[model samples]
Target: FRQIVVEFLRPPTHSDEQIRSMKAKANFPTDIGRRLRFENAFCRAWDLNLPPQQQHDVRQHILSYMLVFTTASRMRGIHPDGAPGLFDHTYEDNQVVWKPAPEDAAGMPAQAYGMQNGSADRAMGCLLV
Candidate 1:
């Protein structure tokens, strides 16, 4: 599962034109289309011999992994200054600095897809089950 996730996140060898074509045909963003492709590949490779229950469980695990991966990626985009260490602690006059506002901290990942109010957490909860 970890190997699958790593492979999915690996840089695609497709040229820019090929990627644009894929995104256009999928009628969605490139990242989303790529995720769907990876999901299908995972299903093909692993779902063939598994019992139904195990298949569902493995699928959920992969979904949860993808959610966390993409959420972290979005957060990094929104807070590039924290890219080196998202939770890095710094003190200024004995007070912690660099804290993100609640909305800023929670909103970016959710808002990336027009979701609101910590929907990322709800999505992860569902996927983890």
Candidate 2:
């Protein structure tokens, strides 16, 4: 899995500092910075839930989900909708989906004729969340 990521992408376009800024974007409305921190801890450790105060921190709770989504986006088995291709509970009742469809030879995602369509916004959607 590590090989797949290292094999394909260039060095992360985000520097450690840029990534840091993303984590520091904490005010009232955005909590990603706080959440990204502990979300990383649990990724390597066991399934330990964040402590209640920590978990309830508006900043942490929201960013925790963002952290999960961003991290999962790197794996090959994840669907464009942010669902785990091989794992269960990848999505939830109100999770907003932002998946891309297959592209054509012209190097563009196929268009969907539906009420809700995929958007290029998926790439940066994590920021707003």
lDDT of each: 0.23, 0.25
lDDT of 1 by residue, 47-90 (tens): 11111112111011111122222121111112222222222221
TM-score for each model: 0.20, 0.23
Model 1: what TM-score? 0.20
Poorest lDDT segment (10 consecutive residues) of candidate 2: 108-117
List clash counts for every candidate, in order: 0, 4
The pairs that clash in candidate 1 are none
Among the numbered candidates, top lDDT falls to 2
lDDT measured at residue 31 in model 1 versus the true structure, 0 to 100: 34
